[model samples]
Target: MGRTFHRYKPQKIFEKELQTSEFYDCKEKKWVAVIPKMKYRFVIALKSDYPREVFDAPKYYMMKVVWKNGKEQVFEADTKDALGDAILRFRTNECFWNNLGRYAYRVYLDWVNKSGRLLQ
Candidate 1:
């Protein structure tokens, strides 16, 4: 057996919005589609609930997405710290921080570093 390591392939989609596919609403007979694919994206997930913060500073963007039988994984957009929270709210909105914002994103990174939250 050999050890395996994941290469640092930052997802480009993290800087953008997350979208999802659409299914035909048989009852309504309406072709519905989610603007962004949130199936495997967290930044996109943020938009589903938090739109205003999507463009907030600090610029939190999606990094990556992984799925297992009962778990998920994700990553961030920028390597540098500091920025506003206005755009960082969404995991997809990428941008560099100013100065003070660096610390804020660092703290946020604590939660951001997690692969995924356990489904309670």
Candidate 2:
């Protein structure tokens, strides 16, 4: 139905939530919401080491996200600077789980193919 990229699909449905206490400045002993709202992310399932030609590429790293209000999003992973750095900028607290998530990492040489099902 949709753009089939390497057999990646919605196998599992879950959202990895990131929550933390409101930040409180030392000088100002008061707590404040980070954004005055809650944050949510999604998790989807896809194939591992999925062949290139599937999406007219060599491989794929697909992901699904469920937003707050129940919305689904699917997209590919972009590799420009560094994957580790990307994780650091986003999931700093849960970066440890990056290497153990549904995100797929591939290259022309050695590659990593895994889904949320197998990894998580």
Candidate 3:
């Protein structure tokens, strides 16, 4: 039995692929990357800032949430109830007492509870 191998022809310089830019202007051969003006959400791990050895027994998950138009909210809690209260403080500060806010609060509540729903 014999086998035949096929080789692809080398592409010309004009046919070579190039990196694409979302903000590129092909006609002008220029690109200006655009940064979004709005920030929707952020989950920051505040615990990583401290070394593990600093704690006798780490009692809290230090965390931060940056939500809607660059507002930042921070919390440190060991228990589910504490976390819920912290989140409530944030929600209150942001004036998130509306119906939509309640739904979002539920989601955040579910996340903060290690055992079960505390804010519900």
Candidate 4:
């Protein structure tokens, strides 16, 4: 058997916009993307150990929304584009949070039903 490797071309469209204000979080030891809006602050953390490089499509990433009330909601995605799309959707619609939360809940239910394991 031979190992085959596939190379994916990095998508720079969102990366260009997101790269403007990325900073390393010493506490988490990961690069985090920050986009501040009037209602809340959107943050995306990439699961990478190397500090020098930021992958355009990180295999694991987390999206977090921090509102003025100090309550936060966190969502995890396997690719950066998924989180980016969520952010773009929210930016366009103020009511997107309700939909986002519903969608996340549905996904969680599906996962639990299929895997028969609770998410930690």
Q: Pick the candidate with the highest TM-score.
A: 3
Q: Model 4 compared with the native: what TM-score? A: 0.31
lDDT of 3 by residue, 1-120 (tens): 865444332221111111212243445655455355323242323233334444443445434545444575555566545655665665553234331234334545545463354533
Candidate 4: deviation at residue 83, Å?
A: 2.3
Judged by whole-model lDDT over C-alpha atoms, candidate 4 comes out at: 0.45
Candidate 3, superposed: residue stretches over 4 Å from native: 1-39, 42-50, 90-104, 112-120
- Assess the local accuracy of residue 44 in candidate 2 as a C-alpha lDDT between 0 and 100: 33
For model 2, where is the 10-residue window of minimal lDDT?
Answer: 104-113
Instruction: List model 4 lDDT by residue over 1-120, tens digit each.
Output: 975545543221211011133434555656566565224444445553333334554345665555445677776666544654544455444344442443343443443355454545
| Alpha-carbon runs more than 4 Å astray in model 1 | 1-56, 79-120
Estimate candidate 2's alpha-carbon lDDT, on a 0 to 1 scale.
0.38
Model 3 alpha-carbon miss at residue 74, Å: 1.4
TM-scores of the candidates are: 0.21, 0.29, 0.40, 0.31
| Candidate 1 local lDDT, 1-120, one digit each (tens) | 975543333234322222336434545656566455323223222212233333443334443333222244443434322222433554342222221223334434544445353323
lDDT, candidate 1, residue 52?
36
lDDT of 2 by residue, 1-120 (tens): 777545434334223544433454434645556665534454533334554445534433345544435665454544422332443344443432232222322221112222222321
All candidates in order of TM-score, best leading = 3, 4, 2, 1
lDDT of each: 0.35, 0.38, 0.42, 0.45
